[model samples]
Target: MNITYDWNKGVWSNLPLGVKVSKLHKFNALPVQFSGSYEYNFANAAVVPEWSVNLTVKLLFPM
Candidate 1:
């Protein structure tokens, strides 16, 4: 879990609050892992999105 906040004077209300949540999963039988995240912005801006999401996969090789 994660949380973020930002203050911008140029933006509306002088605040550009944001929140993010993420998760990670790992398998014991396999060398594969997965992770995902979601973010939301609570600022009235022209170039910012209200919500966003991301996903990632990783493979671990044994040496």
Candidate 2:
């Protein structure tokens, strides 16, 4: 399974100083992997993106 998401904030400045870009992605596999991104403004030199990792746990049920 795979999933992706994004979010943006409203404009709060004439220079678009309050602009925000975010992204979240995930994939279901052995060890679940995920990544998160964050960026502001339109300057390629001022971009900030982050990544994350997650692991899936198995649960056992008893009858």
Candidate 3:
């Protein structure tokens, strides 16, 4: 997700787009992951906040 607006510092901004909810039901292999994120900020009447996280592990070549 991404939203933004800035008209002469009119204040508005946020971004949080993460996906990978346990990665259920793999088709070939490599099924395990997690994702996270958070962000926000404004101007003129400014406010600020931001955060992000990502975890992964994909090693599939054993059949």
Candidate 4:
């Protein structure tokens, strides 16, 4: 499990990026992994904020 928070308001007046969370899981001994993450942006107030999710699969080969 991993979590991150980014506060760029101090550096940039219009920057207010919020948070991101991610998780990883192993499927098998074959070196396969599943990972997902969620991100949010807080800079825009006029627009509705929605959570975005991303997923990816990883495979590794060992010699």
Name the candidate that leads on lDDT.
1
lDDT accuracy of residue 54 in candidate 3: 46
Give the per-residue lDDT digits (tens) of candidate 3, residues 1-63: 455565666756553444434443455665534344443332222333454444555544455
What is candidate 1's lDDT per residue for 1-63, written digit by digit as tens? 233334454444223344444444457755776766765655544455666676777787767
Model 1 clash pairs are none
Residue 26 shift from truth in candidate 2, angstroms: 25
In model 3, the Cα lDDT at residue 5 comes to 64
Relative to the true structure, how large is the alpha-carbon lDDT of every model?
Answer: 0.54, 0.31, 0.45, 0.49
lDDT of 4 by residue, 1-63 (tens): 223333654332222334444444455656666666655644443443444567777786658
TM-score of predicted structure 1: 0.45
Using alpha carbons, what is the TM-score of model 4? 0.43
Error of 3 at 20 (Å): 12
Which structure is stronger by TM-score: 2 or 3? 3
Clash pairs detected, candidate 3: none
**What shift in Å separates residue 32 of candidate 4 from its native position after superposition?**
0.4
Q: Where in model 3 is the C-alpha error above 4 Å?
A: 6-30, 43-63
